[model samples]
Target: MIIVNSVEEFGQRYHSAKRWRRCMEAIANLHRLNPGVCHSIGDSLVYRLVDGAAPAAECFTGNRRYVEIHYYLSGSETVAYAPKPGLQRLAPYSDETDRETFSGAVAGRHAASPGQLLIFDNDYAYQLLGSDHLRKMVLMVTIEGATFHNK
Candidate 1:
């Protein structure tokens, strides 16, 4: 787990970081491969959700399609999920497959303040709770695992 004090620090560290480049490249290829993919971008991509604009929704472990990188620009967003050292469950979107990947790290009460960047691997299961009057910008890069791993 890594944390940066400000968005400038995050940009300096990750905008050009090795992983960032690879992630961008992988995402480009992923879009080319899968056109108009809903799994890539969510309904909130590049859009700001102000307080009372939308209710805080529960975030769960997404499927294995593309990686989700959440770069918090401002405000506070709370992430909740099943804690580790427990049964080790990802997320039970359905009853089945709950016990399969039950040993991975689950995201818990994590805060993404302004200038903080949070990267969730394909397996991390969690939720986002933005603070009241909280304003932030997020960039969701859709990177295919195959291309991401190959490079």
Candidate 2:
């Protein structure tokens, strides 16, 4: 996986919409390669996806040339996200309208929150539960071995 010291590096390579998606696919594969790849950004691990009659959860959506980590310094919510499906992969932005469309077929939720870190793949569809007031820090680290050859 690629690792960047700062967001600038992540931004430089992921400046384009297409390239950023590739990063998302790479990270998504990580989960398949190793389920343990999912973990908190910091200490304490107690996050899970739950199903219910809520606002479909909330998630910060963005793309970078690396795996992105979202830390919930405060606030309690559920995160629902899934990889951009099929040709619609060109989607970006975390707007509600976009989320509803993305959430059409996929599903994700946070069953519990016992820490202050949330790490996930890039550009995937996700939602936070409990409330709309979410305060957290986002970290995007470029994965190693990623190439911009075609981009």
Candidate 3:
């Protein structure tokens, strides 16, 4: 898991990285495009604008094929995440959608506010908790050059 507090930090962290830039550009396009509409840039980058009330409780989700990044555009929320080892699978993972659901105790929670960016790898499950005004831009970038083992 990686959390960037500002865009400057993001730039400093991933200086001139093409994949990261592609992800950032996709997010910028989302800001220019219609709300709640999903967009994709090549096979590697998928992004969308999400605007709605957050779930009442944590609804943990994870993906194996992509690294998930969330940039808060408006409002605030709490993000809860935990390692997947002991989590009960609420829904099986789907290759078509590249997502799985889980239920378990979160290891920690972070207060997410505007201009904050959160990045998560496949090893952890996470959920967002917020009020009716929650809005964020989400990007799913394919994990490059990594092999996964099927259990």
Candidate 4:
């Protein structure tokens, strides 16, 4: 898990920091583009516009196809995160969704404030929640051999 206070921090932590920074700069473009439109820059990298009201995420899920870099531009939320070790399975992984649901105790709570970036690895399970609003972009970077296919 890579947690950074700013995009620069993100750049320092990840190899594709410059590429991720471009995605950060394109938040406005995300608003202009319709939901589900791929902001594809190159192979294995892209971002889709994502936004929702309070309690934006409820269930705990982890991804297999991509590393989830959640950069919040506005609003705030609390994320419950736990290592995916002995977590009980709520649902199996679906290739279509790239998520596996789990039910267990979260070890920590992360503050998802504006300008803060949270990156979850493929095996980390987390849930996002907030009081009134939680708007952010999910920059999905597919791992080796995996690509985000839009349907």
The C-alpha TM-scores of every prediction are: 0.49, 0.40, 0.87, 0.79
Clash count, predicted structure 3: 0
lDDT of 3 by residue, 1-151 (tens): 6889977788778767677888767755764866677788876787888888766664798998999998888888888899988689998889878889999888999988899899999999888766678788888888887444553
lDDT of each: 0.46, 0.42, 0.82, 0.74
lDDT of 2 by residue, 1-151 (tens): 1223333454565566643544334433432332223333222121222222235333334354445555443455666556655214334543332222233444555532423445565546454445544443344444455444444
lDDT of 3: 0.82
Number of the top candidate by lDDT?
3
- Residue runs of model 3 more than 4 Å from their true location after superposition: 146-151
- Candidate 4, residue 43: Cα displacement in angstroms equals 3.5
Model 2 accuracy (lDDT, Cα): 0.42
Candidate 2 local Cα displacement, residue 65, angstroms: 1.8
| Cα error, candidate 4, residue 111 (Å) | 1.2
Roughly what TM-score does model 2 have, to 2 decimal places? Answer: 0.40
Error of 3 at 96 (Å): 0.9
Which of the two candidates, 1 or 3, achieves a greater lDDT against the reference?
3
Pull out the clashing pairs in model 3. none
lDDT of 4 at 140: 78
From the highest lDDT down, the ranking of the candidates is 3, 4, 1, 2
